[model samples]
Target: MRILLLGAEGLLGTTVWATAEADPRVTELVAAGRADVDVTSRDAVRRAVLDVRPDAVINTAALMPADLCDETPEAAYAINALGPRWVSQACAGIDAVPVYVSTDFVFDGAGSQPYPPDGYPRPVQTYGITKLAGEHETRLGSERYLVTRSACLFGPPPRSPRARRCFVDRVAEKASAGGDLKVVDNVITSPTYTRDLATTILDLLYHKAPSGTYHAVNQGVASWYELCRTALDRLGLPAQVTPIQEQNYTTAPRPLHTPLTGTLPDGVRRIRRPWQAALDDYLVQYPALRTDERDVA
Candidate 1:
């Protein structure tokens, strides 16, 4: 399959690029970051898609920082909502499948259980609202598009030195500094490794899974505090971690519990490994994490 990946430099997109490139099934891969194409501009997106003429277009671009989205809603809507629309439209014109990367934040997190793929979205924050809008726009733009939602993504650091590190990286850094870490214990989510999510997506496409919304996450639930502790343990660090309520952290209203749980359509049974296993694999890939341990010692 020939694939065009948007946001190729992002946390998830980087893993997707690596995973797809390593796969024998992907015949051609065209990677485009913001430098290559501005997704917010419909003309730019359409031109890029037409030029590449890929068999599938995977859109991973988005304004993901929830706080930033809360501050600048228009930018969020443009990137997270209309960006997918433009990609889907372009793909539709060329008869290419559009794979949109969505988020678990689309749900309100009212229920204690994991959210089903078919659950109605009631987003409380601007980020979630915009992502939900993106999902709808993708569906509207193409009948054969796939929306895969995951959450709390952590993965190998981007190749760009200027790129910001993910939460797990920051946690490792803080642990190296031997500082106290305070994380939210109330906000539950499925902490997913980007590589695992990328592999699942490839499996879905390889199996020709029916086009629809799917929850692609590691097979467990955990709070931020728990995830942090697990990371520390895997890194062999003795950092002090304090679990606090979400109210003590930020003023933003976020979904308290939004772990996703559902099977992919068309009887495609994709087995998601546990989050712990994924984390272990990530640490092995990025042995730089052990630098923190050496520093502490």
Candidate 2:
């Protein structure tokens, strides 16, 4: 399949690019980052997609940071909401499938149970609101589309200069510097590995799975504090971990508990690896974290 990948330099996008390039199923791949095309510009998105004429357009592009989205609603809406609309429209022109990556933030976090793919969304902040808008736009713009909602993705550092460092990277940084870590114990989420997610997406497309919204995440849920402890223990990082509440972290309102689970169609394979296992795989890449040369995930 010929594929056009947007946000090719992001945390998840970087993995998607590498995964696609190496996969024999992907016959051709075209990567586009912010430098190549501004997704906020409808004409640019349309032109790029139409020009590429790919069988699939995987859109990983977005203004992802919740705090940043809160500070800039207009830019958030433009990139996160309208950008999907534009990409889907272009895909429609060539009968290509549109694959949009959404977030777990769309939920209100009031539910005690894990959220299914079709769970009702009640966005608590600007970021979630805009992402929800993007989801709606993606659905409206194409008849055959896949919207995969994921959370807490961590892997290699993002290549985009504008992207923020992921949670794991931040933890590694603070621990390596001998700084105490004040992590939230209440803000729970279904943390996933970026490479795992990228593989799931490609597998879904290659197998021609049903087109609909799906929750692509790891097998279990974790709070920031639990995740921090797991990383420190696994990587042998000696940083002091101080447990804290959600309110102590940032000014932006956060859903205290939003764990996503797969509701994939019957017969489709799920990304069932646990978060800790995925984290172990991620830690293998960090030489500084390894105590010995043979240490592996």
Candidate 3:
């Protein structure tokens, strides 16, 4: 399979690129970051997809800075919403399957139970709204598109500092610095591993999973505070991390509960491990983090 991975330099995209490149089924991988493909431009998307003529086009691109999206709605819509639309159109034109990675943020977080794939979305922020738009457009435009929603991803150590800004990374930084950490207990969700997600996506392609939305998150639920504690415990760090309410945080309004639920579509299950187990695997992959233990020992 020839695959064109959009946003191939991002936190999750990097893992997807590596996974595809390593797969024997994948004959070609055309990975591109924002510098290579401007998703906001419809013409650029058409040209790129046409040139690649891939069997699958996986999009991991988004204006994911939630706070920035709140401040710049137009920019967020152009990239997050319209970008998917363009990709969908291009994929439809060439009869290629398009896989779009969405977020759990599409829900408002009011439900006490985990959200199913078909659950109605009521996003609370500009970021979530735009992403939801992307989802709807992709679904409406392409018949062979797979829209997968997930949350709280951690993965292989980033190649650069600019790429290292996920929840786990932040916790590691504070723990390494011997600084206090304040995590919001009010916000809860399933945190996933990027490598796991990437592998699952490839499984979906191999199985020719039906074109529909799917929920793929790590097993188990956790508040931000619990996630932090798990990381600290894994790293054997003694950091003062306080649990606080969401209102105390500077980040824009967050969903109270964004855990995704439901079995993967038939023939599309790559990972079903607990989130903590996945975190442990991620930390093991980073030699720097592993050495931190010896230094402390």
Per-model TM-score on C-alpha atoms? 0.95, 0.95, 0.95
Candidate 1 vs. true structure, TM-score: 0.95
Q: Would you list the rank order by lDDT, best first?
A: 1, 2, 3
**Where does model 1 exceed 4 Å of error?**
160-163, 265-271, 291-294
lDDT of each residue in 1-297, candidate 3, tens digit only: 889989888888889999899999899999988888888999998999999999889998888668889999999999899999999999999999888899999999998999999898999999999999999889987888999899988887544345656788778776777678888988999989998899889888888888988888889999989988988888878888999999888567898998999887566555688998888888877756653654542
The collision pairs in model 3 are none
Tell how far residue 246 is off in model 3, in angstroms. 0.7
Q: What is the Å distance of residue 243 in model 1 from its true position? A: 0.9
Q: After superposition, how far is residue 231 of candidate 3 from its true place, in Å?
A: 0.8
Model 1 per-residue lDDT tens digits across residues 1-297:
889999888888888999999989899999998889889999999999999999889998888678789999999999999999999999999989899999988999999989999988999899999999999999999878889999999998865454566789899889888888999999999999988888878788777878899899998999999989999888888888988998788755889999999976453333377888888888889888876436674
Error of 3 at 243 (Å): 0.6
As for candidate 1, its clashing pairs are none
Model 3 lowest lDDT segment of ten? 288-297
| Whole-structure CA lDDT of model 1 | 0.88
Predict model 2's lDDT versus the native: 0.87
Candidate 2 ranges beyond 4 A from true positions: 265-270, 291-297
Model 2 TM-score, all chains together = 0.95
